[model samples]
Target: MKWKKGLTGMLLAAFLCGAPGVGIATPAHASAGEYKFDFGGGTVETGYTGVSASLSYDSARGYGFRTPENMRNVSASVRFLATGTKSENTFDVDLPPGLYEVSVTLGDTSRSSIAAEGVYQVINMTGNGAKDRFQIPVTDGQLNLLVTEGKEGAVFTLSALEIRQLSSNPVTNRTIYIGGDSTVCNYYPLDSSVQAGWGQLLPEFVNTNTFQIRNMASGGQIARGFHQDGQLEAIVQYIKPGDYFILQLGINDTNPKHNESEAEFKDWMRDMIRQVKAKGATVILSTPQGRATDFNANNVHNAENRWYRSAILALAQEEQTPLVDLNVLSSAYFTSIGKNATLALYMNGDTLHPNYGGARELARLVAQDLKRQGLSGF
Candidate 1:
């Protein structure tokens, strides 16, 4: 194993807790500034509009809101010097599900302030009002920031505020590292709309708060191909000890025109497994889902090319890695659904890759095996 280092080197945390919907209350305040809140239930950057605070930074200012053309200033970097003493002050921030470094700097350079995210679910910021920073995990993306105003309605001078994704693992929550090919890539989706990769659907079955499903898989990538594309390196960079790494790549490798002999394929998998294991992460290897098979034996992916899947299974045993036999389970599933139904689950009968339904089935099989093995984060 070359033990690909520096693979990790990107931002990496937290939970999803709250009612079915976040209750955003922008109560009446006597402040002269403006504010924008985004409760991210969907793509739109909109939320409740309460009494305005007019302190929005002017774009002409160099270090202010990097608001995209017509979008709201969700990425604003302004100082709120007057968020009054309302008994309860709460607002939801629309942040993407990922690890972030959140900070709140008070006005005075030598004073104390208690700034927090996740409604006291996370840690508190304590320091000289310069810049108090902390790592925060955002599971559902609609992050809640709670502030309890003083009895006299004092001025809470927020000299600075920062929220950005981390470039390293804070090790806040469990992570499922998905490593695979097109069948598992988080693609943009096709015309009919349901045909997406299985990895994209995996999140639905698992709990986002408990586990972060990091899809590092891509299209046209085998074990060797993934490494060549910097994916393997990226995986190594963030996969901490106790995290789970799912390896599912074989369909692309099985192509006759593709590079690598059977032994080379096996060796590549072995090395990847070894490397992942060294990082203190548990590994799960999955065989690719079976392509569309005609009962009359006329499919291009005939019996001869089936070795790629078996190689994955055999290597799993060789590496003592858990196996999610999608080939067997997916084949049985599509068969139960029948040829027409199976074709419907693909992109207009593109047997090679699965459509949305097919991807869901593949995800179900993996989820079953993962939960079966008692994986921690599912």
Candidate 2:
């Protein structure tokens, strides 16, 4: 079956916390996601099954895949597999997509001298080691644990393999939903890179297969206009329990056509935040970034933008939700960089829209804020 677009690769990933299982849920030890085997036989948790390309499964002989070849990492008692080298053959565990942590115990419980090569897995592991835990991003696919000693043939012991669905709630991984104006729109192969929005660069920072960035932001959308156009409703449709909503609507709302009084803007944002939280999602509020100095100096749009920032700050304070404060960050960035350097990020000398350079910088700042906010799945 087709899973959600962002739910790709391995179902889950793990962050390296000293104690392990920091952000994700921890099941009751080995039982939640563990597998054991034997040469004379083996056993598995209720949800696990071993797969191999070499042999047919038989119930009497344990009805499953065997660890191939002279890579002796298996035993009949509390059997575990140590592996090295990327080989054509491997034993696989079939798993449905979600967040998961794989814990491999390296050696006998009494000994610790298990090491070689192959654990550095990018495409695959071509080494061996005793124990390591990884947050795997799995799709609707098989998790292949390779047990080999490569051509060099090193010896390693494997005992007690444990796998756990990190998130007991099963909704730990999430998507980042962005809602805003052109500033946050995913600018494509446009007239130029300068005609870019920060959203376009956002995906570059995230592992799309794990943390998907849905840039639902458009070229021109205010809170009221977005609602009237059904954009907000459409956004709400796919938002599940584990998701994020970054709302930045002030740029257009601060304009004449979509102008909202400070009080009105605050009211609208408050309602929007309330709606999002009601759906079991986290909502982050961002203020509109600054336009070029010349533009801010001459255009009525600047005053409107300022009003929006005020309202946004008030709303953030009132709700106690996280705030990106893009206005402050962008303003500081421009000030630090100075005019000529900053202008390079502006489009066609227009102070209003940022070019690709600016967008990327904006995205970097946004990503940093997300990390600090702990919205990032660690």
Candidate 3:
């Protein structure tokens, strides 16, 4: 919640629209260059500019719906900005180039996927009083937000919005790019999703003041496939010096359908490491965590993808890169907890993926390893 240097503290108010004595008329351009907007055609809250769904983007106004197709006010009393369009919609706000922390207050019954500057700030989040706050490096002098539906039949709604200028120079903030598989990717309808990746939950443990996470992991992605498909290049384009990249893959590679060899996995990972390191950024190699059922008959934890883990460990040693032995750490922990407790961590009875609780625990292990290694952004 901390901003750049020489900035005073500003306590953001929760969205309490239509509440008596809460709405105060304030000038459209507030002091300190901070902007607050109240959506949903409801009574404008104190110190916020009201924005209706119909308010199309105007250059003179500097903020409004740019692609507000079928977007309209659903409720006035509760303050809801609902969009009927099942497809993706956009909203724009003009601002000077810099790093900004956008805080959005979602409606009580809202489910949404919001991406600022193509970096997902909220993915499939839904529930009562859901709030999304994230920092984005804006180089285009404006913030283009993409909003889409989360769960089926659920609409996207925004109750309030607040933009705080974090730094005039976006480079002051470093990013931690994650390259992995579904076990480390983000999920939607996060409030109710039975499955979640460790990368999706890593932000909860990192120091946001120093680093932002961009999890580029996807389902069924192998080391070679991720690089050959140009996903690694996409991340390399944005990665800058002082940034960090974590590569955690291998589970999908073990599938016979992929037909990837252990040596090839190591080679592809090395190539990725070299490309990322060429940008003057640090590369940290992480072995995938163990599955819920990766245990021996003697109750000793064993990793199903131990071959990939061995390859990664060898590469880490050869490249002299920082390593997070998640397989070992997770396996040891699971063994200590016993079979039944470990099974409860996985989604349903599935052994491959971890549920939300499992994801959180995995992220904690990653963070702890980062700190143990004395890496930056712990």
Which candidate should be chosen as best, given lDDT against the real structure? 3
User: Candidate 3's residue-wise lDDT over 114-231, tens digit each?
Assistant: 5665445555555544555666777887787655555556766666667878778865368888988879877654444678899889988899888888777776789987797545
Instruction: Point out where model 3 deviates above 4 Å.
Output: 1-28, 41-47, 69-89, 105-112, 118-130, 148-160, 185-196, 200-209, 213-238, 253-271, 304-307, 314-320, 355-357
Q: Which lDDT tens digits does candidate 2 get at residues 1-378?
A: 110111124323332111221111112223444333222123322222222223333334322334444233243112224443443334445555655665544432322221111232211111222333444444544455543331233443443334566653334346777878878775433223446778768876766667756566767677876565445664565567778888887877767776576677778778888888888888899887877763344232232346378788888888877999888777777766776777788888587788888888988888888888777552
**Candidate 1 per-residue lDDT over residues 32-132, each given as its tens digit:** 21122222221211222211123122323211212212112121211233232221233334555666655443332222223234122111122223333
Off by over 4 Å in 2: 1-173, 190-194, 294-307
- Candidate 2 clash total? 26
Local error of candidate 2 at residue 185 (angstroms): 0.6
**lDDT at residue 362 of model 1 (Cα atoms):** 80
The runs of at least 3 residues in candidate 1 whose Cα sits more than 4 Å from the true structure, single-residue gaps closed, are: 1-169, 189-193, 294-307
In order, candidate lDDTs are 0.54, 0.54, 0.72
Give the lowest summed-lDDT range of ten residues in model 1: 1-10
Best by TM-score: 3
